[model samples]
Target: MACRVLEYLILPLVGAKTLIVGAKSVNYMKKNASTALRVRWSGSIRGGYSSNHGSRFYFTFDRAPCTGPAGIEAVDWTGASRNYHQHIEFEGLCNNIPAGHMQIGFNVGTLPGISWQPYLGWTTSGKPKITAEEVDLGENKGMCPHHTVFNVKQHTLATADTDSGIYGASAFRYTKLAPDTSLRVRWFGALGAKSQSPAPGCLRFYFTFNGEECKSPTPIDGAIAWLTDPIIQTRTTHSSQGDYAVALNVGQCLFGNLNQMDPDPHVNDVSRIIVEEVRLGKSQFAEQAVLLTCSFESSSICGFTQSTNDDFNWTRRSGGTSSSYTGPSSAYSGSYYMYIETSSPRVLGDTAVLYTPNLNLAGGCGRLVFRYHAYGSSLGYLRVKLYNGQHMTQQLWAYSGYSKNTWQETNVYFKQGGNFQIAFEGVRGRGVTGDIAIDAVAVFNVSSSYCNSPNRDLPKAAQQVFNLRHWNWYNLNFTGLGEIKSMIYPKISSTSGLRVSMTATVMTSQRLGPCTQWQFRFGGHVCPVPTHSVEGSRYTYSYQTTTQHLFPITVSGICTGLPAENLVLSIHTSSCGGSPAVDAVTGWQTSFFVSAEEVVLP
Candidate 1:
């Protein structure tokens, strides 16, 4: 999305002279002044002026035209209400405009409250300048349309329009009114026995032109009426007879073909329009229907394909096999489920994939809902993936650990086009407990409420705040002493006031001796010790450590920082007698993460 253009004009008046200050140039005028005085102040003036009480002068500040990319506009001037002392303050303007070459123009004049000439100076103030761009404000971004796809049942009129006084017979009939016209249907019906009691209802209209059905279904309301009650002849009440008039654009209904050729060439140039109706029924426009459902109840497998990288394969089971395979006895809804079981005692890095049939998700959101079981000590992971024919695959949902032996349901949504399919993948861990199962898989085509709406990308300002959860971890494993491992963060320009917090998960075969201490250092400074610990086994222990550090790092242009900018998360175990290993066969591993955010000081 493009940035909104902001235009501002600063008008300063001194006697009869008016000074117009814009983002690009300053216009100055002097009334009743001599040609000599006008010639002296006709051109541009640079630098500050000294106080001269005898001469009356008016000043204006204007920046030159910016020579950069498009969508760059001038700074918004907040007028002269911010005048402090004798200086007219122009602050909070756009940072993109060049400030170094700003020209200040002055015109001499005489007016009241101008007994003393004001001095001007351009210098940096104590407060920090805002260098943020306008696009960072997250305004004027893309928005989705409220209604894009709808499915409504058709409705028809009860009485013929020839005898009805409201509409003619031609209005109810599907006729070609014009070359670019739409299909319109209007109907009126009686609500009760009398015309005094009103009972309103709704009607839906569907159109088909040239053997092609319309995509959008529209609904209309009935007209109001007043009818006399049969129980009390004198009592007359307001009621509604479901009366509706619907118009469907021929071009949209016929899939962009306004002038559809008639199938019967012998007939006239007019094309036939078939109409259907469903009266007094609620609109099902927003309700989405289930496009695909799989219960895994039969041996046919419901047209689902299974794949595996290794020898392990997903098996169809109707009952539990053994104690290790203590999962759902049957499927969530049926008596069968697709499960992947690893060989007992030893677990291998095995993967089993089950994919759905090719689904048509063009111009709509596809919702995949399924139930999964992942419960065991050494349980593996269950991941749901979406594959688009364009060579793009997205991981929709993933579960790694146990789920209390109960079936858990999850929903994943994605927007796709062309040919697409959803795949259920089960990764086997290193033990017999690496068993997982899936059942009750369903896919739905949800109506798009906001189709083709404008969407804005995350602004550069918000990207400065680094979340530790978002950073990818770099693992290191070793015994005895460890080297200083450094990880460089992605660089960002035009920033200052740097602060960072580091987090890590350290799993060791054994704990370091009480006397022997280990420390994590970054930027030549020792980080804080581990504050949290989780005990897994007698020889295996997991420690979570966190530490914060402030650095004087200033970045401008495309400048990369010093060695200190590259954070080093290392364990100084050489000084201690004990050895702490990371991600080794001795059951040790370490994962490091850092959260670095920029602080803009005012």
Candidate 2:
């Protein structure tokens, strides 16, 4: 058998503007950011040999795992921190020879791209053969998703089956990607931590990358995945064997481990999930995505009019209220998206109401109560009072500002059925009132189980479902300059602005390479501003890409302006002469927050 241990490094190269990438050789890392904790590790098996049922490779980190490919070290595998990485290739192995009879192979780790799969194989008379047929790849063993071949970059990898094991060989072909194209993007996923057992099928995965909260230096509170089950396919059907189908359960919840499963399995038990090879089928590739928007068409207009009581005469509604988009009163069918902000200072005897129609349709699951989003602290939390009229209030739910700006989705099932309603009324502080955008009000079986279990993606950790949203785009064009609306909830501290200023990530096309001539163009620049008027809060950014770095080129910029206006974020012609500049953020006052490593597309 022939095997080769190959590896690639995701170096956290310094940015022209700024960069916080860690060492390429690190395995486990723990650092205290401004307001949040940042931990990164390597889940891939350090390029190596074929072990038996007994021999294995292992590792561990001091802190938990972060998202995507992080750094890895060779030490963290001793005692207390018990994590192990193994390579069980039963096919056959030759001494570590580049061109011998037996060959062993492994990828360093993956980068942000969709095309290309990696594996181990052998070569001889110009003919290559595959091995390792008996490993149960479908099962969730020690191996995880990143180790599988299916997770390789889609551009250069293809799925090919052999008599023994499956492999996605790099067709030894070099095809140039569309310049300024992002190889991998946040097209699909549920946010936050999730479970892997008793499988819940497909977890809600989101696509758009909102800016995260920046504490002091590094940006905190962005997409940090709770990884598990990096399994790869061996034969047919969806049956998991050794480590196939690395299952990731998605839910609508918070980012913390304790925030999802009470005991927090993800927080304690596992840190990372890595698998080996994956064959990218068109269908699998297509289905590997998250939705761009939330639905609010079937909203149950469940709030008391300001007509109730006397004195303050404010509306009695406390939960799931909205100002943006349309209220439930607008549409009797289809879908709608709206935001509900909170009004403060507390008014007594102020009961809220949710209006709903019988619709008289059969197979009705009941009023799908969807609170687009909410803000404030635990004490100042927005409480949703769901009622079936008779039982009056069936639930008193709170959407905290802890998971601020992030969109959370949960389907509420009505108990007494018939025409129902969902209302919000704050007892302390100002009652929940703002553009709590509510949409995709679906009519499903109102489930009151209160999953509380967040998904591996962002959709599950959110307290309010900000549907009709977007994902981290590949090669995207911003919709021009627009206002970025803040979520009803905010993570406020004197140090960090309950928010991080956002910039656009455009995908531009320009030929680049080892010989491509380029220089920094600094002087010729125009600027726009936000209405909030917070000076010195923004930063400008730009980059250079080669033929290797395609689209999905993320561009990150800081802001010096808040409450400013008409901020036009455009890509300039690089000194290398690239074509067409695409906008990243429509410049809308987005409800979500994001701070990412911006890569200028090829």
Candidate 3:
């Protein structure tokens, strides 16, 4: 809720230079004289929960402003098995200047400069090339509109243009993001037909941040294009349309322009472009107090509503339900959900419900979590009422008959003191199979035994060794330096006894008793904190006013000296200066993996 993590050094780089980082052994090198590059980083990082320990970072560079003298021969580290995030490569070369100016900067000596963003490419001699930096896709588009195809060796950006209103854009630019963070944008194409009338041949997304842009209430001229609800006309081939990631506190730069609009070029394409860092429960203090979540997977209906006196209105569907043996041939997670097909003008009890948008459980307690799908044999029934505006004040879940065919996961747990709204309700039964579906409908406020104890905050399958499920939230800028490296190999070959941990779950508007600082390093050791805590409870939420701290901060040891192949885990943080700077948001429902302890022999 408050922020700071700043430090900048343009590094002008001139004469006298020589460097080597991450050792490669050249007799430990040091021979180019002139004096200007030293660089050294050993291990032992440890320091989570904040108190500002040690703090020191100073490395400057900038010798070839544009066309001469640029030293820096080696600085390796790449992908390392890849998953959460990794890579730090740089070989160095300059002086040619056929016209390439140079501008590498992949960043992360101290994280937040937009949390390490780089994906620009160009080198026909104009310089400014950098390619692998992912979790989705960031910058990369110097040109691609002759009808489309920017494939610089498969980075992808297709098109056929097909006329209608004319469109073929593919621009992208993401930089310096911090505040609340969560921009994602993903892609995979389709839309040649299956559904495409006044719409479908779509992939319209346009955004600009900081200077402000993205009006989208459904804009096309004032622009605000697609923050969600874009399926490109429901499949025609390649899948994964992604495009429902937009949660920003606006810390600065972010520009995404992806337009593929084609009316019918033939098959339509979109290929790749990801920007992940998504988060949605499983940890991080167990999805703290979220009021509503909805995974209807856009194209509308994520707000859930129906009732002009319901008789036949609850069908956002996708996949099945034209008759057959009842609904759902897909979607329990994404692509769409929300149903009540019932076949032929519908009959029997005939109801359709669906409402939710009035939650205010500041302290009335809550927890909803949903997922449903009833299979065949003429089924019907899926209630879950609780209105409080005028009628129906509690039913909290009810299901009948066929409860399996796959999707089924419910957890109600409630208590209401004030505002409320949640309806659902679908009853139909007896006939063309009845249908009935629902999808990830989340709503949490905690406690009911931590909303049915879903691993109370993991790490104890006997010390556990691989958990991977990260959701990274952000906000911590002491002016400029930020850090968040991750790369865990842990298949165990030798870290001897193994032990490494880090816990976090923070939010604040004020209550700075130990602000929010961390400093953990894995493979190379220095992870010793033994144990730490502050979870004495302090939640309070209606939709964020801040005040949710649960810094379970625990760092164990016995790294046995460390090193098992690039293992890295670095997490650095700073700023306990007083108020403002403790909003780790704890990566949405938590998990930053790397733990070990299976050595049991009798």
State each model's CA lDDT, in order.
Answer: 0.34, 0.23, 0.37
Residue-level lDDT for 261 in candidate 2: 21
Error of 2 at 276 (Å): 9.6
Regarding lDDT, does 2 or 3 come out ahead? 3
By summed lDDT, which 10 consecutive residues of candidate 2 come out lowest?
122-131
Task: Tell me model 3's lDDT, rounded to 2 decimals.
Answer: 0.37
Model 3 misses residue 323 by how many Å?
A: 6.0
Worst lDDT 10-window in candidate 3 = 228-237
For residues 409-489, could you state the per-residue lDDT of candidate 1 as single tens digits? Answer: 675666776678887878887677667888877776654532332321222212222211112233333344444344443
Candidate 3 residue runs with Cα over 4 Å from true position: 1-288, 291-319, 323-329, 332-336, 347-351, 355-360, 363-386, 389-419, 424-438, 444-602
Considering lDDT, where higher is better, how would the candidates rank from best to worst? 3, 1, 2
TM-score of each: 0.30, 0.28, 0.22
What is the lDDT for 514 in model 2? Answer: 14
Give residue 234's error in model 1 in angstroms: 26
